[model samples]
Target: MVEPIGGASTGALVPPDDYFDVIKHICKKYDILLILDEVMTGMGRTGAMYAYEHWNIKADIIALSKGLTSGYFPVGAILTTDEIVDDMMEKGGFAHGHTLAGNPMGCAVALEVYNVIEDEGLVENSAKMGKLLIQGLNKLAKRYSIIGQVRGKGLLTAIEIVKPGTKKDIFPPEMDVNHLIADWAFKDGLILYPRRPINGLRGDHILIAPPLISDKAVIEELLELLDKTLARSMFMLG
Candidate 1:
């Protein structure tokens, strides 16, 4: 399974330009099943209705949740090709179901969520605002030497915090720079998702996922708040 935008596992990491294309080629060559874990990057999170759409990837199966019901209701879904499902059905059953499987309310909410995304032009907004997000984060990176890298696709983005003047060098893990940055920002009312890019063991980065409905003005205010947090972080490092 793969996260098209890498999600929290790799700190909103976007694969290289050729990575997905190459993977698709390899999967086709070997007749391998290509599955995508789109729980975080789906439902218009990665500037597209589905992150795989960015690469025109043909996935055998795709997992989705979170954005499906916009958190108004709990729901999850799996999308697979007819070939796969038909084969499973013919072989008896997949035996994969939940107690609330196909619950009416959850399904209804998920459908409305998609409609809202379209009506609000959130997908388009994500693509436009996403560029601003990356640009804003890059500016902060330029000012804060501790910021090692800034990356993401659409609103699903993050910054890798590093020891200043060292190429991708991590600080003492006890310092917990990721959480420190997030905590600092939280005090100012800007919530950030902190994660260890290196498998929860080490490495510091914070995921910044602005709401799809966010406007430029809101994003600018967010960046201003983040500026303050980074300054505090710099002081702590010093």
Candidate 2:
């Protein structure tokens, strides 16, 4: 079996470290290939060169995008072991190519983005501030009935919203509680992702992925607004 993985993904595993170890063991036993999806969590988004690197585990392939070019230009990469590359080349050079894939302008910009990330030490900063953000959210969860859980590593975190008084009953979209929170957050100058479940109205969560360059003060400001938004939105859901 070949498994597709994402860093700190909601459905994959929690705490990330454990997930890597567990998957590595499973792969060893089942002779499976691990394919990591690093689009959202790649290129220092999770305060590591690549999010998977933090786990000290290796994968057979990794699909990277999003922060790879810092959103300056559209581009993506398929990083894999030499065996995979050799096999594909033997089969006659990647059977796919996009007109814009090798654009020089995009390549140049992406290079600069990499340099900026390294020079400014944004990845390390992300690691530090991400911890602060998660800690703060956990504190907020202590006082709110609507917050079911706070889980994430680095700048990738999520706040799961559930019905205020129902132990395991999820929030219904008829209420759009996540939307209410997102709207409030936007007005507060902090844009966030209120994710949809694979199916409508099944999952309710606000995914938080701030810029890696954010500092403690910025995180505090964002969390302050987030906390306020949570409070007001939770009240509205009821």
Candidate 3:
């Protein structure tokens, strides 16, 4: 089956050239089709027109959602290379589609959203802000052992929480440290997304994804709220 192996959200990209190299290596070795999910990381969320552009790898197919209408409307789009399209057509259009596949209203809104991202320079702004956020988050990680890993590209990033004393002893099931921090951040006026697993036993991640319109001031505010919430949440110790 085909799946995306390497991608980034809005975050630091000091050496984007190297990151793409790893993605290329994996694609070659596995002989798998690279499907780029540009939902949160697309349409300038990464300061690039598309997150994959930063990696400089051409994707066989790209699934886009979320930012298409800038959250004003729900929409999705699929892009594929000419060869893939030809093959799919030869196979009877690939036999898949959604109810609103060609809804005019959604299309209109998505069109405008694309226009705005390009016209307002939001993509470039996201890239710049991503660097700032990565730097700040890295500092926070250094100060707090609760943080296990910080990685992302553009505006899409996640902070992994673990036990305070032992890196391997991640917060226990009863504690749900990811939810605790998410709740804490919400109470502090910074909304964050907590990753959830189907079994409710293996998920532990906090996603930091803000609107593309956010500026440095807003990003700083979010960072402060996140850092403070993480510091105060006691779930990690339990």
Candidate 4:
């Protein structure tokens, strides 16, 4: 299984030149069943209709949620090839169904969400805004010693908080740096998702996923607020 965008678990964006494409090649070579968990990256959150589209590789099964209904209602879906469905049907008509599976209201809402996304060209907006967001974050990284790295694709992005001016250095766990930053940002009227360290027992990172429909001005405002929030948080930390 693979998370196309990596989300909160890893600040690393799946670049075309990186592991995602290589893993696709390997999975095909070995006839492995590839499952793409696109819960966070699906529905144009990553600039593409699906995050896998960025790699131009297909997965045997794809799971989608979150943006399926734009959080207007709780809904999710799994997509698979007809061959897979046929196999399941032959074995007993597929053995699973949710209590609210195929509810007309949810399906209708989801359909409207798709229509709105397409009509407003949200996917294209995500791509454009994403570039600006990354550029702004990189600039911030240069200015802030605590910002170790900035990485993202489309509206999905993250910044790693680290010890200032130290090589390969991360803030100690006891600092709760990520959570502190998030709390500060929230109190300042911005919300961010904090992630714990992927390596060792401690590290600090925060995920930033702005709405796909955000315009340049709104993004600029977000960055400005973030800048203030970071400065305040660092001051308190010190």
Candidate 5:
């Protein structure tokens, strides 16, 4: 089992270039079932409709949620190959002992949601805006010494924080440091997701995922607000 792209646990940590390729090769060699947890990286969040597409690999099982309903309704789904389904059916047909198994309302919402995502080209938008976001952050990193690293894909992205000229040297946790920029941005009407990815103790970073439909202008405004927020945080930390 894998996360494809590490989600909240690692703050959207994307693995090395060949990580998935290597995994797929190993799985094929060993004839092992590959499972992907796409709860956070699926449904166009990672710009490609599915993060696995970035590696062009196939998995035996894929779990999806969150974006499946776009927060309009609480729903989730699982996808698997016909081979697996046929095997399961032969072994007594499996059991579906959970609620919402086939709720017509949820099915309808999911259908409409899928159509909207396709019809509106939100997947392409996420890819487009994601590139703009990364480019903007790379430029901002040049100005802010506190921004140690910028990473992530599509609408799911994050920035690592560090003290000047040092890698992984974060501000004292007691200062509520990781969240300072988030708070500053909030006051300026922008929301940022702050997280402590290093053992959930000392390390600090902020996840920034704009709406899938955000345009270039919205991203520019976001970058400007983020610039101001970083400036305030640097001053306060210094």
Candidate 6:
């Protein structure tokens, strides 16, 4: 079973420590293989080398990409225990191949990326900047009627846009309020992830994942732009 630490598509984050404890225990008891998909949350983006490390749970397998080469080169990796490798070898090797399977250039670039992350302490920077981001977003939530929930972990965060004065009163799909806010932000020189309807429902959310190297000043500037954008969107929607 594969589970993502912070769901990139949905913009929802699973609680780190306790939640994984139960999952790890259940999977162990049932002799199930636990696979962690860290493609989005890996390589110091989530304030750690891997988000799963925050839970201290060992997965049977892990998938990694994107941050592997810091987007300089396309590369991905799958990791598993030695036991699994031995079993696969006995069964005539694992069945998987891609055009870039053994690209030496990609591997070399990925290694350099790792060195940069470690040498510059990007993981710690992510944690610090993430806190600033959450604080700023929460303040915006209090000030803006269109803002609903503000939630996320590390640098992965989300804000749900809804009708004013209602907890879960999502705007109708046709309104596309989330998209409007994103467009306004973009025009103001801030690029955010595209809006998404929650669980195919009317509720809309936008994800905010700044680069791991971002600082508190940059996050504050982002909040300022977002605040202006939301105000404009709310007036237009109303």
Best by TM-score: 1
Tens-digit lDDT track for model 5 on 52-137? 99887898999988889887888888899999999999998867667657788888898898999999999999999999999999
Error of 3 at 173 (Å): 1.4
Q: Is candidate 2 or candidate 6 better by TM-score?
A: 6
Better of 1 and 2 by lDDT: 1
Q: What is the lDDT of candidate 5?
A: 0.88
**lDDT score of model 3?**
0.73
Rank candidates, lDDT, best first. 1, 5, 4, 6, 2, 3
Q: Which ten residues in a row have the lowest lDDT in candidate 2?
A: 1-10
Put down candidate 1 lDDT per residue, 65-158, tens digits, no spaces: 9999997898999999999999999999788777889999999999999999999999999999999999999999989988999989999999
RMSD of each: 1.2, 2.6, 3.8, 1.8, 1.3, 1.8
TM-score for each of the candidates: 0.96, 0.88, 0.82, 0.93, 0.95, 0.92
How displaced is residue 89 in candidate 3, in Å? Answer: 3.8
Between candidates 4 and 6, the one scoring higher on lDDT is: 4
Best by lDDT: 1
Candidate 5 wrong stretches, greater than 4 Å: none
Supply the TM-score for candidate 4. Answer: 0.93
Deviation in Å, model 6, residue 135 alpha carbon: 0.9
Over 22-88, each residue of candidate 2 has an lDDT whose tens digit, in order, gives 8888988998888887877788877687877666788898887778899978878878999988998
Give, for candidate 5, the lowest lDDT window spanning 10 residues.
Answer: 94-103
Q: For residues 1-238, could you state the per-residue lDDT of candidate 6 as single tens digits? A: 5545555566745574578778878998999999998888888777778888777788889998998998879899988999989999999997888876979998999899999999999999988888889899999898887778887777888888878878678788877777778888999999987556456656588889998889778899889899888888768874
* Candidate 3 per-residue C-alpha lDDT over 190-223 given as tens digits, one digit per residue, 9 for 90 to 100: 8887774526755466777677888999889988
Local distance difference test, each candidate: 0.91, 0.77, 0.73, 0.85, 0.88, 0.82
Each candidate structure's count of clashing pairs? 0, 0, 9, 0, 0, 0
Comparing 4 with 6 on TM-score, the higher-scoring candidate is: 4
Worst 10 residues of 6 by lDDT: 1-10
